[model samples]
Target: MLGIQNLSLFIASGLLLNVIPGPDSLLIMARSATQGWRAGSAAALGVGAGTMMHVLAAAAGLSALLATSAAAFAIVKWVGAAYIVYVGIALLRSKPGKAAAPAALPPQPYRRIFLQGFLTNVLNPKVAIFFLAFVPQFISADAPSKPLALVVLGCVFNFNGMLWCHALAVFTAFASQRMRLKPRVTAWLSRLTGGLFIGLGLKLALSKPN
Candidate 1:
C-alpha cells in the first residue's frame, strides 16, 4: 500500500529469516532457559527495538555509509565482535550453585537483559547492511517517498520478527521447565552457549564486508 511491491514475498522471507538461528535467537533461548519467560521477553523486546534503529538508519541512508565505507564498517565490526566475546566469557565463567539449579546462575535484572539484547543486535553492522540491501528491493523506484516506504516495510519486518522471537522465548522456557534441569546441566548449558557465542564473535571478526 505504501508503494511497496512483493509485500507477501517480503513477509514470508522475513518470517523464514527470523526462524534461522543467530545471536538474537541464541540470546532469547539462553535467557529463557536460564531465567524465565520474562527475561526472554525482555531480550526479544530489546532486539525488536534495535531493529527499529536499523530501519531508521536505512531510511536515512546512513546504512549506505557502512556499505561503502571500509573504515566505518571495520570499526563497528571490531567493537561488536569484542562485545559478543566478552558476554560469552561472562557466561563461561558463571558458576553453578551446589544446592539448586536455579542458583546455577543468578537471574539478571530485566533492564540489563534488555540492554544486552539491544546492544547485541544494534552493534552488528551486518544488520544495517542487511536492511539497506534487503528492504529496498521491495520499494518501488517511483514511490511517493522511498524513505517512508522503507520505514513501513521495516516496521512490518520487525513486527513479524517480534512474534517469532517471543514465541521462541516462551517455548524454550516451557521446555526447560518441563525437563527439570539439574544444576550441573544448567551450568553446562551456560558454558555451551558461551562457547557458541565466542565462535560467532570470532566469525564476525573475520567477516569481510558484503
Candidate 2:
C-alpha cells in the first residue's frame, strides 16, 4: 500500500497537473464554452478516459516502452495530435445555429458527446509519456517491486486527475450559464475552442520527447 507521505505528494502533484492548461484542460474548456454543460461534461469524460488509459499503461509496464522507444512514442504522439486536429475541424465546421450547449447534451443520453470526449483522450500518446515522466518522481527505481510501485502511483494519479475533471465540470458549469443566453458569444467560443485544440495538436506533432 502507498504511504501517507507519498499519498499527500501524489494528491498534490495531481492537483497541480490538473490545474495546468494542457490539451485536456483546453479540450474540456473549449467544448463546455462552445456547446453547453453536457458537451463539456462529455469532453471531460473523454479526458478522464484518457487519464485512465495513462494510469493503466503505467501500471501494465506500458510506460517502460513509452520511455524507451522513440518510434512508439512518435506513433502515439502523431496519432493523438491528428485526432485532436480532426476534432477541432469538426467543431469549426459544426452547424453554428444547431447543437445544444455542452451541458444540455450530457443529461439527455448524449452518448455521442461522451464518446467524442472519451476518444480524444484514448488516442493521445502524450498522456502515456506524461505518466512515464511524472510518476517516476515519487517512485524509487531501486525499490522492491518496481512494477507494483508504478501501478500504485498510476492509480493515485488517475484518482487525482478525475477529481480535477469533476471540479472543472462543476466550476465551468457555473460560467456556462452566462454563456448560454448569448448564442453569438457561444458560437465564437466554440470556434476558439476548436482552434485551441488544433493548435495543441500541431504543437504536439512537432514536440520532441524530453
Best by lDDT: 1
- How many Å off is the CA of 145 in candidate 2? 2.6
lDDT string for model 1 (47-105, tens) is 99999999999999989999999999999899999988988898899887575456455
What are the per-residue Cα lDDT tens digits for candidate 2 across 175-200? 87764545555556666777888998
Score each candidate by Cα lDDT: 0.91, 0.70
Count backbone clashes in candidate 1: 0
Off by over 4 Å in 1: 101-103
Number of colliding residue pairs in each model: 0, 13
TM-score of every model? 0.97, 0.83
Residue 15's lDDT within candidate 1 is 98
